[model samples]
Target chain A: MFQGRIIDTKLRKLSIQDAEKFIASSDFGASIFFSGTVRNQNDNKSVIGITYDTHDALVIQSFEEIYNEANEKLEIKNKAVFIDHAKGYLNLGEISIIIAVATKHREEAYKLSRYIIEEIKKRSPIWKKEHYQNSESNWLKGNPLVNEKN
Target chain B: MKVKIELFGATRDFSDQNILELSLNNDSTIEDARIEIIKYLKKNFDGNKDFVRIVNTSAFSSENNNIVSDNYKIKNNEKIAIIPPIGGG
Candidate 1:
């Protein structure tokens, strides 16, 4: 099973407990959870907050694509995967993303968790704008999207 | 003919709106739309070269949410989106 969603701050907050609950199961012996937090500093500047913008429909599509790719590449068929990302301004030390995986062993769980996050960063149409302490903010340059079919 | 493009991420600050409208000739391709967007960005945000670079590197996704190539024909009132570089965890 795979679950991916964007947590809109206006509606709800992204939480670890929800991710844990989604992937909890007696069928798996290992559960790996990864949470990406907004830190205080970036490029030596004080990061007061970050606002994450996403193309909602395309993002959901990318999530499903990533999950399917992980399934094929890792060869781990029976598993539970939960991914939730925040879609609004997050203060320092706030959780921006959570990737939880439950599999039959620790190795697949760890590999799947890492693989999904990396692929999401590369493929998903999500952007981050960092607000500094002095009231200045800038959008961080990210990996350019390249379509192989183009 | 005209096309409406939904802006996201860094482009949001440039236009100050989520959607941008561009006028084009008949049967204009996605490449033409890209050029028009670059012109609009340059004309409005003249001093900012960074945003222009974003336009150059961006991809256009059709209403169906699939990335279309530069040669894809543009239809009147077709809603598309300019997807800039992405970075998420």
Candidate 2:
């Protein structure tokens, strides 16, 4: 079983606890959780916060595709996956994303966790705007989608 | 033909609008649309080459959720999305 969702900060926060519980099962012996937090600095600049914007529908689509790809590539049939990303402004140290996975073995759990995050970074239609200390902000440059092979 | 382009990321912030409407000749392709959009951005932003460069790297997607190539023809009143670079964890 797997689930993917975009968490709107205005409505509610992204909870690691929920993800942990969602991926927990008696049958799975290994569980892994990964969380991305808004850092206080980047590229020699002091960051106050970050605002994440997303193409809501497309982002979900990408998440589902990533999950399916992981299932196929990892060859792990029995698994539980939970993924949630924050939408809206987040302060430093706040969680931006969480990925939870449960599998029958530690190796599968670790590989699946790593694969999901890397794929999401390269594929998801989400953007980040960093707020700096001097009341300035800029949308960060990301992996180009235009040159993708059709 | 007229089509609506939904902006995202830097494009949306630079344009300050979620959607931008454009008029094109009949049966224009995505390449034509990309050129027109870049022209608009260049003119409005007073030759901000950096922004223009970013928009040039963007890809357009049809409402059916496919990243279309420049050769894909546009239909009248079609709603397309400008997908800029993606960075999510």
Candidate 3:
């Protein structure tokens, strides 16, 4: 059985220690974690905050697709994946997204972690609005990079 | 009649929230609904011309078109989602 959780909350409440402990007791030999933080600068402009928006239904569907793809591509005894994103107002240094993957070996853990993030960025409908310190805000569009594989 | 208007992406930012409910007359069209939204938002945020864009239930729609046809009437509790162009990293 695969476990998935999606939440919108204050980033300060996220317990990294609890996540690490849970993965450790799951009998997994290796674990990988990815955290995306609010950057202070973008395009040489000082960022004040970010507002992330999403078509919630489409986002949830895309997440499920990514989860299934990760399961198919990785070979492991057991796996646990958690993705939490913050909506509304987020300040600098706050964790906007946290992804944790547990596997039986280091190589699979690393590979799966990278793959999941890339796919999420490529396929998800979530969008971000970056607010600069200069009283200007701009929306960061979806991936402009084309997939080399295709 | 009451209709549920769902705002997504940039539209949500413009409205400062995700969902809005509006009461319209029996003859209201999608264009009318949009106009009501535009009027409501202009009271809060300036720059009306640049913010005009639309997304239908399934895909993106133009500013001049009606989201629902005359034959298809929107009743109480019916939902329509409006999506602005998506921007993400």
Candidate 4:
């Protein structure tokens, strides 16, 4: 069985104790967890805050698709996935996204965890608006690495 | 006839406006509307061949994958959504 969840919440304060408790309920032998936090710097500019805006319907649907695809392609036993990203204003050091996966073996767990993060970064329809110290804000488009237009 | 075009993602940023009101002939197809949109947006946007997807009602049509013909009638006040691919961490 593979469990997956996508939520919008303030996860910066996500505690390790709570994560341990969630992992404790599972019978898997190995667990992998990943957290994405708001970085204070971007392209040498000091980012004061970020606002994430998303097409709610499409984002949720795309996330479900990614989750399903990861489960089908990864060789894992009794996997569980949890993702939470904030929707409104997020300050520096706030947790942007959290992913945790569990499996019976370490290899599969590690591989699947990395794969999910990559796919989400590439495919998800979420967009971010970054605000700098000078009170300037711009809506950034897509993955900076893959989607940058030449 | 008039049609409402709703923009999403980077497409909205390119347009600098979220909604566009397009006046078209009664027999105009969706493709015609798109061409006019492309021409209007070309003044502000650099890329002419930028790929975009259209959502009419609930159906999704990609500019590369789907074909819109003259038989396609866009009703007045109908809303069409334009979506561009979005990527972020």
Candidate 5:
């Protein structure tokens, strides 16, 4: 099972409990989940919140590629992958994203979980805007990842 | 030929609209499309060239989703995307 979504709304943060329930029925023995929350500070400034944005069609395509590519490298089998990204705005300490991977073995489960999140960050057509405590919000870099890294 | 340019993240915010359309010469290359889009961004959308990039949507469906160059030729009714540096996790 592969589930990937961009939840674009002004609602409250998502719950990791829901993600665990979604993974509950997995027949695989090993499961690892990762959740990213909004931080209170970044790069020396106080970060109040962040607004995430995405183009869904391309986002979905990127997630599929991440899953397939990870499997090719990691021998992923009987696996379930799910990733949900929060769009709109999120407050500090709010759940911004969730990633859960289930596999027949613990190693593959852990490895794929990391790979999936990294790929989504690296390839997914998603963007973020950081709202500071006192200053105007600043838009973070967009989808051309490597150029920004270099 | 006409091409639709989609914007996401900061690009969408800068442009205000998620999609922009351009009509180009039939023989226009991707380079032409890019110049036209950038011109529109500066003129109408208050967009800054230094903060933006052109991403070929066609290349995304291939094995590698690398951004294509301006030398690539444009197709009729093709849709391209104007992307900024991605910050999502």
Candidate 6:
């Protein structure tokens, strides 16, 4: 299964709790939960914060598509993919994205989890804007994984 | 034909609006539309070459939504988006 949400608030403790609850409730043999947090530095710069922006109509399909592709390519059966991405400003060390996956096998869970994160990086049309303590800002460069094939 | 291109992320800053209204020839493709947008950005916004990318309806929704190629034709009234690099996790 594929599940996703575009969260407008910072996610941290609550997101972890929710992920734990979700996997525990399932009968999967192994599971992984990944969180992408905003760090205080980027390329040696003291970053104060960052904000994520995305079109509401966009990338929702990207999430589902990535999960489905992972299921088929990884040969994993009976799996669940959950993704929650923040939509607005996030301070340093805040959780910007959370991903959880449950699968019938440990290896499959690990592989699928990595694949999902990479795919989200490549395919999702979500944008990040970084703010510096000096008030300079710029959009970081990103590329979709599928774009590499083109 | 004409299409309304939505601006997202850094593209919004370049266009100064959430949406960009541009016109194309009767059978213009996505690439053609992109050319027009780039031109507008260059002329009016001093846009540099390496800054924008296009994510069509296919970014999530359909098999038909291939990342636009030079010959990728566009349908009339289709919603196309001009976006900067996405930073989502």
Q: Kindly list the per-residue Cα lDDT of model 3 for residues A49-145, writing each as its tens digit.
A: 8887765566566666777876566654367666655566688887777778788778888887788777777656667888998898977644422
Indicate whether candidate 4 or candidate 6 has the larger DockQ. Answer: 6
Task: Give the per-residue lDDT of model 6 (tens digit) for B1-89.
Answer: 76887777766675566777888887887667767776776787566645434332122211234345546666777777654456578
Which scores higher on DockQ, 2 or 6? 2
Off by over 4 Å in 1: A147-150
For each candidate, give the TM-score of chain B. 0.94, 0.92, 0.63, 0.61, 0.67, 0.68
Name the weakest run of 10 consecutive residues (lDDT summed) in model 2 chain A. A141-150
Candidates 5 and 6 compared: the better one by TM-score is 6
Candidate 3 residue spans exceeding 4 A from truth: A1-3, A10-12, A55-58, A74-77, A143-150, B1-3, B13-76, B83-89
Q: Model 5, B1-89: lDDT tens per residue? A: 88777766665654556777899999676567656766776776566545435332222221133455556666788777655556577
Interface RMSD of 3: 8.4
TM-score of each prediction:
0.96, 0.96, 0.67, 0.69, 0.82, 0.83
Candidate 1 docks at the CAPRI level of medium
Question: For residues A1-150, what per-residue lDDT tens digits would candidate 5 score against the true structure?
Answer: 788877765755576776777777648899888999999888898999998887677788888888887756877756888888888888888888899888888988889998888878877777888999897898775456433210
DockQ, 0 to 1 scale, candidate 6: 0.46
Residue pairs with colliding backbones in model 5 are A141-B85, A141-B86, A142-B84, A142-B85, A142-B86, A143-B86
Model 2: CA > 4 A from native: A148-150
Residue range A31-121, candidate 6, lDDT tens digits: 8999999888888887998888986555777887887777578787688778888888888998988889998888888898899888788
**Candidate 2, residues A1-150: lDDT per residue as tens digits?**
988999998889899899988987899999999999999999999999999999888888998888888757889889899999999999999999999999999999999999999989988999999999999999999999877421
User: Which candidate's DockQ is highest?
Assistant: 1
User: Candidate 3 falls in which docking quality class?
Assistant: incorrect
Please write out the lDDT profile of model 4 over residues A1-150, one tens digit for every residue.
Answer: 333333455544444444555565446888877888789998888999887765555556666677677656874436666655556677898776777777778888899879888887765666678899999987664542122222
Determine the TM-score of chain B of model 1.
0.94
Each prediction's DockQ against the real complex? 0.63, 0.62, 0.19, 0.28, 0.44, 0.46
